[model samples]
Target chain A: MSSSSSADSRRQFLRQFGLTAAATAVAGPTVALATSPSTMQYDDQKKLGFAIVGLGKFAQQQMMPAFKECKHARITALVSGSPDKARKLAREYGVEEKNIYSYDNFDSIKDNPAVDVVYIVLPPGLHAEYTIRAAKAGKHVLCEKPMANSVADCQKMIEACEKAGKKLMIAYRAQFEPFNLDAIARIKKGELGKLRQITADHGRSVKPTEEPAEAWRVQKKLAGGGSLMDIGIYSLNATRYLTGEEPVEVTAQEFSDKSDPRFKEVEDTIHFTLRFPSGVLASCTSSYSIQEVKRFRAFGDKAWLDLDPATDYYEHHMTIGDKDGKRQPKIKEGNQFAAELDHMAECVLQNKTPKTPGEEGLKDIRLVMAIYEAARTGKRVKV
Target chain B: MSSSSSADSRRQFLRQFGLTAAATAVAGPTVALATSPSTMQYDDQKKLGFAIVGLGKFAQQQMMPAFKECKHARITALVSGSPDKARKLAREYGVEEKNIYSYDNFDSIKDNPAVDVVYIVLPPGLHAEYTIRAAKAGKHVLCEKPMANSVADCQKMIEACEKAGKKLMIAYRAQFEPFNLDAIARIKKGELGKLRQITADHGRSVKPTEEPAEAWRVQKKLAGGGSLMDIGIYSLNATRYLTGEEPVEVTAQEFSDKSDPRFKEVEDTIHFTLRFPSGVLASCTSSYSIQEVKRFRAFGDKAWLDLDPATDYYEHHMTIGDKDGKRQPKIKEGNQFAAELDHMAECVLQNKTPKTPGEEGLKDIRLVMAIYEAARTGKRVKV
Candidate 1:
């Protein structure tokens, strides 16, 4: 990091955190009684207040609801072009009116010491812009994935955060997903011996010609690429985490029906194969025009672990298989969004880097670009 | 076809078929009453007898047993290199000693009018030789899937049958499997709307270092090309039939661990994508080093049909899914082997082309060879 010393910046960050906690305590004699039941699950002094940028469906539906269950994170601010939506959500979350900031004045969030983190959940194209601005505002940044449109943009986002001495973490919820974490733990324990193959298929029937809000997902400027960028990254990222290795090479194939107006702006499907140094091959596919399928499997010489509907927002199922037979194993489930939020907050308070930081997000985008190159050139590409 | 007059040859083929049935009728006036219960289930006179060539486990377990349930076919002869094994099965099935022939004396089966069709169930490498020899013996041929090891060989097998005025059929039981047929029927009737993509994953945990009899499956001389020729063909063939169109191009990738003894002679994993003329793409994969998986799905605009453990010897399941939700559909199942045996016999008796004819098998082999080329070259190859 370009900071004279990251420890010094982190100390400064915690000083502001300490001051906010002291102020909250001084303002309320019975702070424990005033807080919501969910807040009582964990120490509120260790928690970080986050300002969520972009009140999109994903932000409103998945993130806001998950905040109520977070042990180390709380919604302190809301940034949106729509003031009414932001005001209503702020009132519901007991967020002060002073913490509400529109995109036009998002820069002024720097004065609000209550928000120790700015979570950028905007479209991919705007990720770099908002992340850089957020870093300049001296708050740690938690950005949504497919970090940016290009490797250059991803690098710039990372460097911008480093220059400002603020930590930047890409919000990859899968890293905190319990079922996926269990699969990785099982692989490490040799439950599936000598992992030889990994297969992941994730897709949904998405009509790109729908409302502009949904159609932006297929626009090159907004989405950067099609299924491989939007949905396929899940499998790509999963393969990496499953093997804990980088792919040496990749070959990809993609198609989109031109006659279908939904595919006029972007490809609807992509299939790619990755070769890791251990000789473990991963075959992955993602489609916007196909049936919904969220499944992945890690195959080995002795047995295999399969997860059907693996990466859904909730309720993931797992099956273990061998020559004898297949059996479903019980799993302790948790909200992925809440889990990631707690993890990110923990990293901030402990002065540690997040598991899925900007560099990890950059690597995923690099592989996605390579997949596009291979698919376009009709040949294998070195990763 | 080399035949100067196909109609004349078909008539001649039916004349020989009629002669065999008439001879059987004349030999015994109480034929219907004297035959086994299985044979009495159908018209004894209308049934064409099949010479079971190569009494391997596949023939003995799947075919020899299915004949009892066939309404238009009956087992009349047994051919094998192992005399004791062939003789034992011959006795069990009530085959005359004269009808049983060794590989060395296989050509002499021509003198036995009771053997109207020679079912070649040998390894892929030997399919062409046996098919041509059977055609030369002037009998209709029901060869196993993967007509031969190469496209050139597949062509020769087809031509040999044509020149000898005998019909040749490839035994692709998937076409006759009840659940699969229902899926096709649903697609044909537009139950799933416009078919956009197809996916198939078929594999089994195979240790090629095991017994020689089972190890021959990984030998190029016997199995042709490891998993693709041995098992991957199921997904390849399924995609072709489900699309009802030939793939215009194919891209393939394969992997095997050099440290694993099971993959010493051939690759254990392969993934390929096929692009059809209608812009539909099919992603398929097969592996010898993974856990057992037999599944395929046809994704459409409205819904998708998934079959778990599809194309297995028995107990196929089907699930229908739409944007509304997923539902399991009850499918009236039938034994694939029995269904195919009946279909092949009906084709021979009616002088009609078999649903999975030698030409169909030739097309599949052509694509399989193309897949190998793509996998080796790491480039897309036109079919």
Candidate 2:
């Protein structure tokens, strides 16, 4: 639809919903329709086209189903290393045959106007390469987290997207989840007063009991460090987000046993402290042998925000507490993945930025690097 | 009231309340009635007389009122440098004229059987001298917090008390407070699962505002340091009590301003990390110029225990969050001071060891000394 017609339809939709539409038009035709969908010409909702780049277990089981339920976005293309799985998923999702692309033929999708955004669900090692390549192919990128395995990789991905003039948003779904967002809002609004300290931990028993001799996760070159880079990055990111300050220094300790075959390549558990500029310190831990899911807390003078099972894979809850009274009310039953998908779509259509931007991902990667350095040197590391 | 009659009355009170009287009966004759009183048993209270060694502001304000409400305890003697104020307070509290003792005549309280316990509320530098003398005098002791300024002093005080066979308990009131005790109980019960991280921060805006330096709180010899020894020691004690673990190592950073006259003799802020044997790491900070107060968080696999404004001077709140699919429930409107006082009374009357024993205080003092050493040497110090 034309920009004027789309704007008119959005206005009509807003009016029907008893909401006011912005008078001025935004940059794109999609922006106008996204802003006001009340009195437009088109009756059908315009869906932003998304493409899945990796047909891994997570994509097959979680992301694919989440996309099906998304109102603003739809899966239109598939790119995978496995041709059989790619063909099956593409057919199941009703994508056109021409929209299917292999790893080697991913660049051809640049000219296939149907795909507007590419969600990079590849392994940790390949995230930087695919993100850069996708950006060069003129597609907005939603890269899965740890952003890239290293700070340099994150910076490169961000620069590549900047050069290509495409949005590069890291998929830190926690930033978009309702409970966590509420926590962020409460913290930013000074509901917790001056944040004095933060504590975050994420762990789970991911030990391979009777699996293969060596998985990609157990490989240092592919996954970086074991728990710190894999799951501990969440603790680091969430702490920074809640405190709203970059850490000045870090002191960390790692536990790894070569005798345990699972920990042959990387550390099994890691603990670190981040000293912020505001004098707020964060104590964080991540472990792969522990059966704990997620936890986070931000404490201040007047109140505090705590999330128990904070980064739960599926559901999460957040609570705020006042100094004199009990904990503030909580927002429960939040789906991080669904919330993130919707946010990404909003960022694309509305010309906004994702909450977990490339810079944020880079900062976490830097802290992670420093933690690893500190653990190795047996000394505090400045970031 | 005779011991036998007191015991009978205690049993009657316990039976009326449907409680076990056997617990109090085992405590012995002197404690029989005090252990389980039906009302504020003023007649049977016996009035164990107390001698305030240092008539400081805290002693005059906090301890005097506490003693007034204490059924079995009374401020019968005063030892102070300010004879005029001591005489005035002694008359007001209805102490016998002969019970009023000056600093030079403090030894007289040793011979006077009227004074049973000597409360050392003196400066940190003076704690060693008075506590030793009080121990020599064979008086039970309840020294104010930081037990003594140094680890050596803490050790000496404990030894003196042990040698004299008189109880020495530090005023680490958090152990007795209901909210803190509840948090400890929840943590010990494994309600939050395996304890992973402990975070605590205690700070206040204690900066002087052009007033003449009147209080001993700003003096290094008196208060030890700005915030760490004054309020931050509570965090240290709370972490140990809540985790039930001793930290193996500590790394610290201290900030002081030679330019600011107020901080010339002490640190303005300090940040430290404690690594426990169970791999639970604690990040703690204390500041004198910060606009924040006490907080503590104990995180575990299944849930967390959070106390924001944890060290509420008047009121406190405890929140327990479980991974049961919703927000954690909170216990509110808790009075920490009254609970702490009652617990101390119970310990004395029932002959029970306090949760915050002299040993706990000594451990915290050792940790504090290690933190100071680390800050000075710019290296991690083993505790």
Candidate 3:
């Protein structure tokens, strides 16, 4: 695809998200790779420089590799507790030694003009702290999902970013993926007729049965809830976007077998139903003890569409069924993480609101808390 | 298929249902068409005779035609409020003039020994009335789904049948359909691992918007509770039989736009969530204003299975997914109504309990009432 066609596609894609003119203008201009003023020869000053905090597995595997495909974003610095591992990845990715910093001296990043954006990819308990600190340090923040451990923390982070006049975006990468964007476009166009219901699920077995629950994700204080805070948010967010409606009430149930070692500290599964104000209902489930299963199916009065592995990085695909017949529409595929990163970069440079700001993240957190309440009380709780 | 192979398959199928020895013996022995002692040459005394009440669209199109494939069942009588229509279908299906009766003279069926089973295919309000009259006539009863208009009526029908020393079965044909049976067999065999959740929906558009509400189904007094009574029962019953567990609580919501004439007296849509005692949860939806959408998906710890158009007569198909990959097993296809009719016939012939008895239908009726209460009050209702 040429740059002009890419720009057109991005325009069409961002339109479904209701992006503003400033965001659209950022997509039209091309930024040439410019070296930093300091000895960091690999740093591109024209592109938004991202300081990646927490060099964990997901950051190293998905986000680091995705920077190669981003047009307006580049990783300029790394902040990690392990200096040796951070130095090894910096050498492989061509980052200068001066740009690399350990957690002990993370506050010194404010002095580095090379880092324009701070991407926090730490555990749930640390998200609000780092986001507020980054905003105070005069840098845009791209925080990973679930915002924080509680709704109060999310609000604090949002207020901090607003006080600092810095852009704050949540890493809801599915909102930027091509397949989900196409689905939203079709629904908005009324291609599937009046929306009625949405059903989605995301599940995967993380490790072997014999594995111990030593990971931060299995710790309740660090991860917040269980699978709901991790993967269930995808289905919940998908329902909101597909129907363009917020749920009015929620009822839920949690399941965990004591015999399963992985669920010693957390729940293994959760099933919930969301009743929308328009009378549309969504059935959602999330599990950490099941084989890979990711799907989103939207039903309307005239037709239906299904997306199996709906939120995957590469294998996401869709099938639309109507009176004519079922057919798989050609959906453009690209790096899932790069689009969100570029969007955040554009939002910062243009001084515009991010598509998925702190408010959107807080909305999901409120629903999650309601779901937990419903499950605990066995009643339908209003959202 | 050879006759012996067919017999073997029938034996295997009936075994899953736990048929009595006499029923199995009847399957083993091939019986030639035997004439009745009277002048009705087409009537076979060896087969159970069914007196079909209410010659409506469903009985005329599906149930009557299915008798041709049933080796143990044959249509021997017709009872209708419209005598002309009764005479018409009776002639076409080879029923003697003396065997046909009007609803006014329905009690006279006791004089005809050829009428062994009374199949009631009327509106929900009339099911209990006809079932009780048929039971009093010393005939087994096979009633269409939603068993009756209320739980009290269902209980009364069961009591009347038990007093008459006759079997009473609900026409939950999906339980006997080959595809659904295969799916159930696999689930029982642990092919999908430990069951965790079930999601299902049944929705369809019936007629144009301008059509008048002339049918009895649109009246609350006759049809009970609209889509939930008409179609939602499929998904509800499926969750029960598939999991072999009854739901302990339910939460539900009903939707209908007043502008739509069809829903002026009834709900056009309903969504409900079921929580089983075993911690298994099922989310189900039904609608009367959507295009055909029938599906049932069961999720488990190690794998999952999906059945699109799960409750259809001929189009139902299933796909299983596991660690190895996804695969579609070739499920046997046959006349959907034949198995249920044959089972009822064998149950009467062998003096055995019907697989789907009146008590089973009453159990579902109790849950249906609970669901309505939950939807009305917006609170979880214990079953």
- DockQ winner: 1
Ranked candidates (TM-score, high to low): 1, 3, 2
lDDT of 3: 0.79
Task: Give the 10-residue window scoring lowest on summed lDDT in candidate 2 chain B.
Answer: B29-38
Q: What 10-residue stretch in candidate 3 chain B is worst by lDDT?
A: B25-34
Q: Per-residue lDDT tens digits of candidate 1, residues A104-192?
A: 56777777898899998877867887888788889999999889889999999999989988889999998899999999999989998
Cα lDDT computed for each candidate against the true fold: 0.79, 0.69, 0.79
Per-residue lDDT of candidate 3, residues A223-332 (tens digit)? 78788988999999999999888899888878877687667777778888898887787888888877778899888888888899899877788999876768899977
Ordered by lDDT, highest first, the candidates read 1, 3, 2
Where is model 3 more than 4 Å wrong at Cα?
Answer: A1-45, A208-214, A258-261, B1-45, B208-214
Best by TM-score: 1
- Residues B278-379, candidate 3: write the lDDT tens digits: 777788888886767788988877788889979987877789888788889897787879999999999998888998999889988999999899888878
Candidate 1 chain A minimal-lDDT segment of 10 residues: A28-37
Query: Which pairs of residues clash in candidate 3, taking residues 3 or more apart in a chain or in different chains?
Result: none
Q: Give DockQ for candidates 1 onward, in order.
A: 0.58, 0.11, 0.38
